[model samples]
Target: MSQVIQDKVIDENLKWSKINHDLIRTMETPGKMWWTAVLVCVAMVACAVAAEIYQYKYGLGSVGLNNPHMWDMYIATFVFWIGMSHAGTLLSAILHIIHAQWRKPIYRFAEAMTTFSLMTAGFFPMIHLGRVWNLYWVLPYVSDRGIWPNFRSPLVWDAFAISTYLSASALFLVIGMIPDMAVLRDHTKGWRKKVYGLMALGWRGDDRQWRNFRRTYMLMACFLIPLAISVHSIVSSDFAMSIMPGWHITSFPPYFVAGALYSGCAAIMTLFVVLRYFYRWEDYMTKNIMEKTCKLTFAIAMVWTYLNLIEFSSVWYGHNVYDKELLIDKATGPYAAVFWTMIICGMVAPFGLVFQSWRRHMPTMFVMSIVLQISMFTERWMIVAPTLSMSHAPHQWDILWGSVIEWAIVFGSFGWFSLLFLLFCKFLPAISTYEVKELCFHLKHEIEEEKREAEQKAKNTSAAGSQQPVSGSPGLEGA
Candidate 1:
């Protein structure tokens, strides 16, 4: 048995080594379209920087904020981005707890999206302040006035929740990358090797190191599950706690969480499709993985749809004059088109995944994911704009449209995110090479074990045949 185990180990190592060689060669080859993508991302950043400078020179008045609709596109975009971050934590932490093998390839990119989206989302509240210099006043720290931030304020809760989530996500990203960083360190040379070597923290594939690493990762996964849920809940509370019409529903927390996960799943799907094709990870990120992702997106999209219906029903049935009026205005007023589009894109189009073909086809799934993301953005806009537009005062019921500068900055944020992701792929192993190798090792062992069992059965059969049936003459004489 000991010898059998040793042989199995050797076989597994050889199989994994071959796979690693193939993976290295594929990743080393740059695609012809890579530079085109880089150029587009650069142009987007430049456009965004110019727009931001213009906003700074002209002031917040240049954008779309008035008496009632103070929180316009910027706030909506912020919420959308923050919600997008939830997918990473869900995939990494929650799925890890459940031991989903498919998550191994997807989790790294998802976590990166979470970290970058959180960073992007952090910018909005500051930009919304307009007088960004006084941003520190939002903190609970001691001020010259000797007053703390209102403990009961939802905005303060948002500040605390977002900060905590960002910190946790950063830590999660670093921890997840450590093993892969060690792989890079082993494979690289010169400056790249030194950088990865330092980041790897002397990981040496020792038994003790593996035990501790797994323990740390498991603990982090446990912590992140609740953190991800609470972060989105807190974000929802920002509006739910408000007494404004269309905002005070009890369903807001779960609704927001669902929306977050819905958009997040879509974003993950989009990124996975891109990465699978761009990195040529057709073997690792299989059709089955894409189908599973789409299934999740469809499930969450249905939940979001149900929540929307419930929200509308509760408001309509309660017969609160303010809530009814706001609902009516949102459904029939100037923003009616956006509201319907949100429903169709967010809730309706995602139903396409019910078809087996749609789930299997990467391009179709990719388009569906993009539509879901766009619709989710529209949902965020609906949440913020409709309430702020149709306030208690009749005279303030003006439609708020984002300025050109606002659009530029928002588009730039996407550019920034894409840019970071692209650079990450170029430098770091986007798919965890070591993790894949480990899986390959396990698979190899399983295959070899089956082969050994089959060989043993064949040998036993041959021995029995020779002993009982080789010479029929002696057996017949005895009979």
Candidate 2:
């Protein structure tokens, strides 16, 4: 029993030492590329802010919105950002539930993505309301007229769904970080230690604490899985519930969900690739893991393609002339190039996963993931723009080009997300050092046990050889 205790203590000491070394390495590494990413993100955000200022001073007319097309790029970008947020939650929650060991290294980064992307997404609905100052109307509260938000409205549902998912995701992220926070707290000396200490929630390496932590984590995983699904579905319903030709489809909810997963997976893959390269985590984020992630990307890509086909097929076979024309416009009209590009990128590109070489190749996987993301963005654009551009009234048919200000805001939003993630990697531990240590310990014990078994087998074989007659000596005597 004493020996066991001593072994555990030594194991923990070694673990902490390794963690401290990694922390120093992360801090010392001059992340020039990370700085460049930060600058680009900042520039994007600045443009977005400038656009907002122009819109606030001028009016809603600054954007391309009219009678038939009330919702524009803002709404499409909002949905796209929200869908991007779903990837992190899906990767973290699903992997946790399945007890995937590889997830230990990647979940922290993915969870960070979820939180920051959701924060960026939350900004859109408010900005889209034009009178951003009157955003309080969406809140569920008492009014002088004593009326509540309409429960039947899909918009209200979106408000609830996004709020719930965001809160739950935040909680899950913090909870999962407790152990790592404790590690940081212990390793740091002054102010950093104090900050991390509070965040660690007074975590102690005790059995009872671990038991509670495990139970709470399991519950959060259960909650997050369904919450993510419902959030995207509600966002899709915002379009589907509308009477617009392209928007009024029963398949929107599931199709949106699949697209969300596809894009989310792609974003996560991109993050993993970047993190692995920048952090020197070749051991943690191995080719094997990348291969597995690509397989998932391929699978979700197929689902997205199927849904696209289903949506198009229904449009083609239906008797409604309006819907038929809308479909025709999407295929051969002004947006045909974007529509075809989305198909080739989202559908055809991912088919490369069928080849074993492509799955294992890092550069190929990274390029494919980027292409998939761009395609998903185009898919969202097609959903919003083409429909609005080709309204039922021929006189109302107008091309909605994104204004300079609009472009800035959109670019800034992307910057905002990237900046947060890049800063997170720089200051905090990117890979969970403590979790990696635990995995190493587990692997070490497994190897030790195998070695012992092999040694015992060798000893047995030697004893058997001694007990048996020497075949060569016997033959020589007989001769």
List the candidates' TM-scores in order.
Answer: 0.88, 0.89
Q: Using lDDT, give the best candidate's number.
A: 1
| Segments of candidate 2 deviating more than 4 angstroms | 1-16, 27-36, 445-479
Task: List clashing residue pairs in candidate 2.
Answer: 44-412, 45-412, 48-409
**lDDT tens readout by residue for model 1, 18-57:** 5455445544546668778888998998988898788777
Residue 90 of model 2 has an lDDT of 72
Candidate 1: lDDT of 269? Answer: 90
What C-alpha lDDT does candidate 2 achieve relative to the native structure?
0.81
- In candidate 1 the C-alpha lDDT for residue 460 amounts to 100
